[model samples]
Target: MREWHADYLDACNRHDLDAIRSFLSPSVRRAHLPSGSDAWIDDLAELFTAFPDWRWRRVQLIAEEDRLAVHLRAGGTHAAAFRGIAPTRRHVNVAEFAMYRVMDRRIAEYSGTGDHIELLAQLHGGLPT
Candidate 1:
């Protein structure tokens, strides 16, 4: 199970949408709680398009039976608008935590949290020194 999770993270780092989807069941139910969003598949496909160079680095991963929780950092240059924010062309890295519900060895649901304020601040002119 940990190996599967590692592979999924690797796929995310690679920004391979198809490879990432391979870890999801056909009927996967995705829940992006932070934004109150849901989907059957392609949950994060749009994010890739927004941050073309986005990447994730896992800080830690914990698994308890069918559920897995991960602490990680995700970042990329703001090359395009996201959630209505115009492109900033600045690099931003933010810490994020996510929980995944696995079913039949696939991710059936996912909920994550991140510091949007920090991200937004960075997009404007980066963090204050």
Candidate 2:
């Protein structure tokens, strides 16, 4: 599982959407996003467009049976608008955490949170009111 996850992260780091899609089940459910992998892929595409150099580094990973959890540090330069905020060309790094349920060696379901408040603050130069 560790090796598999490493490969998955590598694919993500490369921004290889097709490779990333190969790691997800057709019916994969991303609890925070829409119901399927297509929506998840679209979301990633938007992020890539907004931050062409976006990257994620794994801070921690834990696996037990069919479950896996990870802590990640995500960083990117604001080269394009995001979530109604215009580009400020600032770089931001934020923490993200996620847990996955794997079935048939593909991610079946997952839920996670990213430090969006911190990201917004970094982009806006301070916490928003």
Candidate 3:
């Protein structure tokens, strides 16, 4: 399972959606906590469209039973509009944490939280003075 997480992280960094999808089960469910968005795959595809170079580097991975948690840093250049925010074309890095439930050696569900406030502040030119 550790190796699976490692490979998953690598796939994400490489933007290899094929590989990423291979590890996901048909019933997979994923959520972005900050935005309260739930999506299976289309949202992810849109994200990659917005940040073509977006990548996640795993800081740590922990697993207990069928649940796995990953700590990572996510960053990329803001090249397109996202979440109703126009592109600022700025590079942003934010900390993120995700938990996944594995069923039958595939990811069945995932929920993740990221530093969206910091990300938005960076996008909007460092918040209000």
lDDT string for model 2 (1-129, tens) is 888889988988899999999989988988756777797788788888888999999999999999999999888999999888999898888888989998988899988884266788888888432
TM-score ranking, high to low: 2, 3, 1
**TM-scores of all predicted structures:** 0.78, 0.91, 0.81
Cα lDDT for residue 106, model 1?
78
Local accuracy by lDDT, each model: 0.73, 0.85, 0.76
Lowest summed lDDT over 10 consecutive residues: which window, candidate 1?
34-43
Q: Clashes per prediction?
A: 0, 0, 0
Segments in model 1 whose C-alpha atoms lie over 4 Å from true places? 32-43, 114-118, 124-129
lDDT of 2: 0.85
Measured by TM-score, the strongest candidate is 2
Residue 4 C-alpha lDDT in model 1: 91
Prediction 3 TM-score vs. true: 0.81
Q: Per-residue lDDT of 82-105 in model 1, one digit per residue for the tens?
A: 777888777788888878889887
Regions of candidate 3 where Cα sits further than 4 Å from its true position: 31-38, 114-118, 127-129
Least accurate 10 contiguous residues by lDDT in model 2: 120-129
Q: Which candidate is the best by lDDT?
A: 2
